[model samples]
Target: MADGEPPKPPPRLEESVKQSQLSPQILYSDVVKAHSQPYSQQPFELNTIFDAESSALKEISTYQGKPSVVFPFSDKQVLVEKLKYVLVGKFSHGRPPMDTIKKFFVSLKLKGDCNSTIFDKKHIFIECVCKEDYYHIWLKLKWFIDGYAMRVFKWSPDFSPMKESSIAPVWIRVECLPLYLFDEMSLLSISNSIGRPISVDPRNINRTMLHSSRICVELDVDKPLLDAILISFKDEVSKNILEKFWVKVFYDEVPLFCSFCCHIGHGTGTCKRRLEDIRSGQGKAEILSADKVFDNMPQAENSTNSTKFVAGNCGSKMGKQIRPSMEWQPIGKHVPNARSDLDNKVAPE
Candidate 1:
């Protein structure tokens, strides 16, 4: 109020708020004091409390719980059995229209009616009405439709759309196998060295053809397939001498093989592992050259007119000469002397 005296400073916001409520320390002390003043109470019966809880749980379980519906085991088995006759097909490079695939099958003039359905927009689920058609479609393993390779797989109970089939039935021609080994047992044993033998060509069973034996084998696509096998047999001229014969194997309609990962369904160019290595600044993974992997196998010549020599005289002498250019033709091309029994069964009508 005096002229020389400064006006009293306004109360601070914090001081104003503090004046309205008790301090935190006082509040905490009061809470502790309250909790420390324990009062006596009558003891409760444990059995009564447990009984009440049990009654509540029973009511909730009986009234609020939902009943689970389980699928019948017999029905599941029947469904799986029906699925056994189904085959799934996927194009290796691209997915063609469903109508185009259906038309292609019709052109083949399949033995029985096959109901084709699109599976996951990427595969074709083929349900064959008759068992004959099912085997016919599945046995071929790969079909060329419009120059695209259509890989067929048998539908199993554990079939998944996200995963690719790593096992396929591949028809392999075992060349350079001596005429003596054309018998069923010998052919089976040789094919077993490559994969699990499924069936031998009908011609091989009758010994009608001696040049090469064809056998269908279930090959694991994840493993590196053998291009040739070495068979050690006692020399016919000398009982004490053992000779090694390298039998060359040729696979028909095998899917893309990856040398980087040594797996099928993908090639080294598209290998995920190689891409990861490159992305991480590690450069490309060391890919094993085909020559290094199959050291003893016969290598194809670079010349257009190169000829493959047959095994003879302990793999020293060439018994027959095969034109390498014509031997491994691209898919969908008809060879001059291709077998008509199975390979060319699905001719366009």
Candidate 2:
């Protein structure tokens, strides 16, 4: 062909096929052998085999399959508007009443405007105008429900089940754990009493750190449970006699792990739970037992056979360290920075 003239259209399909008939073909067995090595033992760089552009395009196309539609908004509207989440599980046999679900979410008065519709027998589509509202509901509902065996998931147009990993246990340093809680089982019992999944960290198992008043604990419980435990301990150490047995509970303000999923480099706000909430809702959370610390108490190894008591006058102010009435406030509100010296306090008869 002349330089100025465009080459004629490629030969007909039949001619091209005939000309390339002798080309060698890669056998399926050869392809299989090429990739037979374990992924870890593979010699080639893993990234080399991955086609980034093609893979990205494939994902984009998959997402585009059932793209979300944005409804037209009024000109006066100033907000970005609402998004929906799909809650799924083996639900009741028929469609759940929409009014009841809507009323339930609204009663919570979560951060957003909430609405619900029966997506199907097994799925409920919940919509919240505010992202915060959408999240709060997911976190609270993921763990337990009154009587329903169901899970909360993000509403996906493609209707695929959301895939999410469970939140992992977080390691937290607990300060002023009572010195009396010496054994692992005792500590575990007390830890479990807070109505959450917790354990004495294995690192503290063999090490003799109970000599110090602080220890590390790993928790898989929800945030509310942790707060409740803190509040409970606060109440315990307020009274004079009870205070002698309990220590002020203090949690590490700066944690190495994510407060949400208990992973590093993140906080509860940016946790995997939220990520899962925005994608597919997480799986069923493990339910914690209602047992409290004192309920299933670990027996003391050594016991005193006999006890001697020194009686004191009921109205005697002889050995009391009288503090100002203002200092007698609730433990939850006012806590001393240092442990109080209860040795000087008057002993009850």
Candidate 3:
């Protein structure tokens, strides 16, 4: 009690508590390390190509691993240029007079430069820069070529794709048509068998051409589908009927694309499959048969005018024609003909 000494300072509570609680602990996990080699020098490849051909077993194996698909929109713009268009018929004995061909293409504005046209021995190939230009050249040269007929086919790796004779409705001349077949009902049935009947010559029901056996029918069908139907019809008739009524598919000098393949720049005559058939003696020798062209029409939306027209409700005016009765008539019976003198502003004497 009598000792002189300095008093000791009290211990800090926070430091003492922290020191007591502190302890070393270990954590464990699988770690992935970067490879020693650079990415370009890596030994492994991401994609693998299998040599095995497709079969039921192969399909079953890959079924679970299939990637999610994105369906293309129907109206999606085709990114690739439709560069090729074909010119059929003999342009010249040798290399087609390139000068004349170039002038023709330049005149049509299809090809601005001489380099765009490539001449083959049997056909001339014109390179169109865009789809629109390709289509324009196709339509322009289809029917009215003076010396050489033009046929535009779809581009394909192995062969030309099947297409219509023309974008417009095809006209088929039915020769040796019996008097009985000239009736509206019969004609309509025939047209329906082929495609949507656009019109029969002398569309007026009263003024139907009874005297002439030949009937010219305009069908709202691409040439290929119509040709297939015609061939089938002709074959069926050939077996039963004695009178060989020739059904002339009027391509009118325009060449047709091969029905076997859906290409635009070549005809069935030049098709590899067709040539092979020819070599094997399986090719058709008769000129009466139309070259089978269409396997199927392009899938179209209801938005197009052609489809709307085929649906028979093209315009707002057709609404009035819808009657409560079963019968349907597009043209009125009592309407005066615009071509007649009575309706003309200046009556012809």
Candidate 4:
């Protein structure tokens, strides 16, 4: 029966067309009339949409003039207290992935779990599960991740991404110290005069090295570093008399410290504070003395003498005159009138 007849249309398509034809149509004139009506007489649907948009715009305008809410000090204190075991670290060369950092710390066999997250896009914020883990990670000072050096710093409530830490733990060697003053208490006393003493080096504790005692101390870069310390002690031969000794202090691998700005990471030549002072006619830039400049230069090795020469500061290739080494007095020798004139020595301009 279907062979000679035409096929019928699909039921859904035919029904859809019938339904469309049955629906009422709005003329172009009717649409124009509706839009031409006053806002009060507009259709409910159109009024509702416009009213919602207007309300949103008004809310945004009101917010534009409102002041930002100030963060309470109590809340900040609570937050910082909770993050006591947190540390902030940043690579000097490259920014490694979070997993790479986590795995690297884990490989060290830390006492507790350490979690790391990207901080300020350039730095890494690490949270340790325990205080032991926190000190273990932080006390190392510097870490190498795939040969890239990462500098770790303690996290504080006032930590800023724009500024580098001014306080750093540095290993300082106290040379010319008497052999009798090699104990922990004596070393700590000497170290305290320099900065906040963290710990005495293992070799110093064991008395393996007698030439100098090494100690890790937390130094504030904003303060002037003491190049030498003056110690007064009772004479071994004459207990009633006091004698003075100068202990030479040597800072190892210290970054560029600005004497003008009293900050680390920059030299006096590039000090912004000095530039501002000069520009404002408040004061002239302070030139570092020869002694201060030489303090920063590496000591040249020599068999005859420990002498330092300034080459470029005088615009001469031959270099300045060699500085003579200080004459160190023997510890046991008693000279009742022996006095320390080392403090009176002045550097030539």
Give the winner by lDDT: 1 or 4: 4
RMSD after Cα superposition, model 2: 23.0
Report the lDDT tens digits of candidate 3 across residue range 40-121: 7667875987656644222132346775544344323332223243223233224435676666666766433323345355
lDDT of all predictions? 0.64, 0.41, 0.38, 0.65
Would you estimate the TM-scores of all the predictions? Answer: 0.45, 0.25, 0.27, 0.50
Candidate with the larger lDDT of 2 and 4: 4
Q: Highest lDDT among the candidates is held by which one?
A: 4
What are the per-model numbers of colliding residue pairs? 0, 3, 14, 0
Choose 2 or 4, whichever is better by TM-score.
4
lDDT for each residue of candidate 1 in 207-304, tens digit (9 for 90 to 100): 78777889987675545444555454556767642443345667776666565554456666677986787678664324334334433222222223
* Model 4 quality (TM-score): 0.50
**Where is model 1 poorest over a 10-residue stretch in terms of lDDT?**
340-349
For candidate 1, what's the RMSD?
A: 22.7
**Model 1 lDDT, residue 61, Cα:** 27
Model 1 residue 76 lDDT? 77
Pairs with backbone N, CA or C atoms under 3 Å apart (clashes), candidate 1: none
How far off is residue 334 in model 2, in Å?
A: 20
Writing each residue's lDDT as its tens digit, candidate 4 over 1-349 gives 3798988766898888888899967799999999999979986754444555453332132346884555557776887888988888977678767778778988989888888888766688999989778777777777899777887887777788766666777788887666677789889887886677878988877888877789987775444454555555456877742444455567876666665554456766677876677678765434434235534433311113232323222233322222334333222222222234334332232
Query: Candidate 2 lDDT, tens digit per residue, 1-349?
Result: 8889987897899987887886766799978887997877777654557666673332232345776534335421423222333333324334446676666676787765666766556666666777566555554334233445455543433444332212223334433444344557755554443323344655456655643223333332223222212211225556534322222233433222343443333544455665675466443232112122212221111212122111112233322322222111121221222124422323232
